[model samples]
Target: MKIQEIREIIKLIDQSTLTEFSYESEGTKIKLKKYESSSIFTNGQQLDSSSVVEQPKVAEVKAALAPVVQQQKEVVTETVEVAEESKLHKIKSPMVGTFYQSSSPSEAAYVQVGSKVTGESIVCIVEAMKLFNEIEAEIDGEIVEILVKDGQLVEYGQPLFLVREN
Candidate 1:
């Protein structure tokens, strides 16, 4: 299905009281669901659903349309350091929230590319429902990349950083 069509469908869903929707055509499948506790799920991944009029993010829509296996293969082939990356440990978010690299706007980021970190080190913060959460690296490693930008909404279990073990 085309992206425009998907957008239209999402708009309609957002306007209505529908709790779940599913569509499949020629191997492309799309599913959208809203939970009672004010969370949206697209193909099993939770999305922020605080506002009824807010549309699903474009990235989430694209992810729902794309074939997971193909996307994985494409990502692996695109990087030259696939071998090195395969060994990198992923620091994932523990909950759905807004990601912040620093404690505050004026502060330096907790960690950056090439930054060395220990298991107890605070790598970043996640803000959910006005509470700030300090996220730890959970492993001894050097940060290779920061996957999400500061202030981006991160889902539970989403990879926040890539670390190469010491």
Candidate 2:
């Protein structure tokens, strides 16, 4: 199945009550399962939700996932910084694609730190599904920071650059 089709299936399953799903077609098999939040049971006895006793396994799981959560928080913090800078305007990706700083490998980047741009200036390119789209700087500004590296995969609405308006 195509990536878009799989994404759609996941969205559909997540919105529905089904916890498990499987599909197979033309030698391609896919399975999806959602975590069920149910009462924990031990020794054939259901534990009370308000029980003071703590589960060792649950504690271990939380400890193991702490670092992953911290990493996600760091990413969110970067986005928040962009939003919090009152004088900086963010150039965000218009689509989910691979970000390119220049038109090609041999060319210099379209814009760099301290570069001046007008509203019609092309700052970068975002390639999605084989189409290369030239992204323009909608506001006249000086590039203060490039938030994404060249050739990086970027999500829609992710900030690509921070600029100070002229």
Candidate 3:
């Protein structure tokens, strides 16, 4: 809100490896950004605006550029623009080892194709060593496909089910 506040924010941002920082209160917003010389280079020289600039104009530009910069970032990772292979919601393993579809070998599988799952449903089990740890779904969706079968070895963070949104 004041010069002292903005100074404190800048100091806090500088203490970390953060390249950008922002704050908003009562219609007032402030941002501190680290501009790398290599990125903003004109020919071979760097553009340095270290001299004292007015607070209002600086805040206005920061507020304006923040959204534009973030939009540019989102443009690259946007799901529609990404290849189809990248859009699959990868249901990954939380731990490494064997993947089991049921609690026991003879029991029915926890989930199968077209199975609907909520956030709390136990999707599968990952046996790390002797302990069989039950893995649960973190989202609500319909199971599209089972990526792995019972008794198969799976790595941590591997997709077990392809859950299509309901």
- Each model's lDDT: 0.84, 0.81, 0.73
Each prediction's RMSD to truth: 20.8, 15.8, 14.7
Per-residue lDDT of model 1, residues 61-108, tens digit only: 456546644655576576647777888999999999999999999999
For residues 1-166, could you state the per-residue lDDT of candidate 3 as single tens digits? 4566466557545544457777654456766787644334567966654532323434554554465456556765664545654654657899889999999988999999888899899999999979999998888888878999888999877888877765
The true-versus-predicted C-alpha distance at residue 103 of model 3, in Å, is 0.3
Candidate 2's C-alpha runs over 4 A off are 1-84
- Kindly give the number of clashing pairs for every candidate: 0, 0, 1
Top lDDT prediction, candidate number: 1
Ranking by TM-score: 1, 2, 3
Which candidate, 1 or 2, would have the higher TM-score against the true structure? 1
Please give the distance, in angstroms, between residue 56's alpha carbon in candidate 2 and its true position after superposition: 48
Q: In model 3, which regions exceed 4 Å deviation?
A: 1-86
